[model samples]
Target: MGTRHRDEGVTMAERPLVVPNPNDPRLTRRLKGLDQDRQPVLSDVVVERPLTLYLNGQEIVTMMTIGDYPECLAVGYLLNQNMLLAGDRISGIDYDEEVETVVVRTERVTNYEQKLSRKVLTSGCAQGTLFGDVLEKFREVKLDRTAVLHTRWLKTLLREIGTLPSLYLVAGAIHGCALCAGDAVILYMEDVGRHNAVDKIAGYMFLNGIAPHDKIFYTTGRLTSEMVIKTVQMQIPILISRSGVTAWGVELAERAGLTLIGRARGRRFLVLAGSERVIFDADAGEDAGA
Candidate 1:
């Protein structure tokens, strides 16, 4: 058996990477806590484990995640941080449960000492970090203008998101993200932090060679600068959430021409940026221009 990478660059197993079961007991623990009525009760809580990612044997950064799809997290985190190049050939991904680490091996030598030296805490709930100016490439990046989101399709997607079985539904302390092709969700991931969910989805897209231009990204967390930047980096145009958006997020979305939709729940939702891409067939409203 040899290592495999996508795009015929490296070789992997015929079967996909072994992703941890979302319902795995190891990912959650039974804890004792007091309820609102001050009653002591035992409940299941989501687990947070530290995963240190190494690129080409060099230590990168340790991320606190829910311990699912760690391979994707490692590769996706590196990609979003700009440490991993688009054409970089990934030779292998190795995970050690006892050590709690993930190493991403690439055919090309990778060193990001200078980039990792500079780090800024982002607005992500899990306290996401950024290596360099994550927005540097946004100026040249343009989303597909022809991509359109129908009002009905948007509603259908939200409804589907609500019906999905998630960690949040069971433990009540996680954020989730969904990658949708039209009204169908291709992948759904949840973690203790929203950033982790986004990173997992990014990893899935990267490894599976999924295109982003026509996909819709939905998150259970508020739309922040970090979320907006990561979504754009994924080259996804439409971002929707049941929560509200921040000023910086709105500004960035407008500049990058990314369709930003937030506060979406039920029949009431708002489109804050890239309004022209939204088709009002269901609502018959005016174009949601920036």
Candidate 2:
């Protein structure tokens, strides 16, 4: 099917698949006496589909993702890779489900040169690969603004945001990614692969005229180099997670001058980079120690 952009622009609710009632009567009664009843169970039905991203007619990369929001995933992937400058740069996106490929048509083909230069293959489940010197590219990132995150605000945002529609809540086999402006979550997405979730958010942002310079990104997954690059590509200043950050992830965040917060739960979180953007009260410091 040909890619169709929303006439009124894209909305967060339009991109991610939603499950109306996660605590359905059937599952609720079925798990009444189970110890892990409240925990999201992993489903074996999740299958990986190959999504080939074509930039301006030139084939980019083939990513394995849960087959939802194929157009958003493709556009977002290109945006994250810095292969796209603006929403208008993309002429169209064609998703051929029969052949399982996504062809992205762009107005200018020159932007993808850097990404097509050198490819490094990795052993990641999502067909992870990096083009050119990823570390060096991150070093040149110039963030537009910084987000000052308070402990209370972080706690409130996470709690409020977690209640939104998510694939993990329904299928119990996906990761979620969100874009927040202060305590308000503007975008949220879920996918069997965390990268796809982030990519979906990126795609929605691109199509909706949302600039990442003034936003905070949150994830229910580990902060890796790929994740870090995605945030950097959006020019987002802060990234918070209920997980851990890899050494490379931390290094990239520091180099890009982005704030990295991990293990964000309750009232405490570890700030790995850009501590200046976090505002903590003196009393909270004492409470953390106590």
Could you report the Cα RMSD, in angstroms, for every candidate shown?
Answer: 5.3, 6.5
Residue 127 in candidate 1, Cα distance off native in Å:
1.1
Worst 10 residues of 1 by lDDT: 1-10
lDDT measured at residue 160 in model 2 versus the true structure, 0 to 100: 70
Off by over 4 Å in 2: 1-44, 110-117, 122-124, 133-136, 281-290
In model 1, state the lDDT of residue 265. Answer: 85
Per-residue lDDT of model 2, residues 1-290, tens digit only: 22244324444454443322344332222222323567554442344567777776778888877677788888887766656655446677789887889988866645566567787654333556666655565667799654576665687678877788654655566678888776677777767678788888888777656666767899998998888887887778999999988998899888888899999887668999999988876246443333
Instruction: Please report, in order, the local distance difference test score of every candidate based on alpha carbons.
Output: 0.82, 0.72
- CA shift at 220, candidate 1, in angstroms? 0.7
Q: Which stretches of model 1 miss by more than 4 angstroms?
A: 1-22, 283-290
36-143 in candidate 1: lDDT tens per residue? 999999998888999999998899988889888899899889889888767777889999989999999988887788887889899898789986657686566778
What's model 1's TM-score?
A: 0.90
Task: Give the number of the best model, judged by lDDT.
Answer: 1
Q: What is the lDDT of candidate 1?
A: 0.82
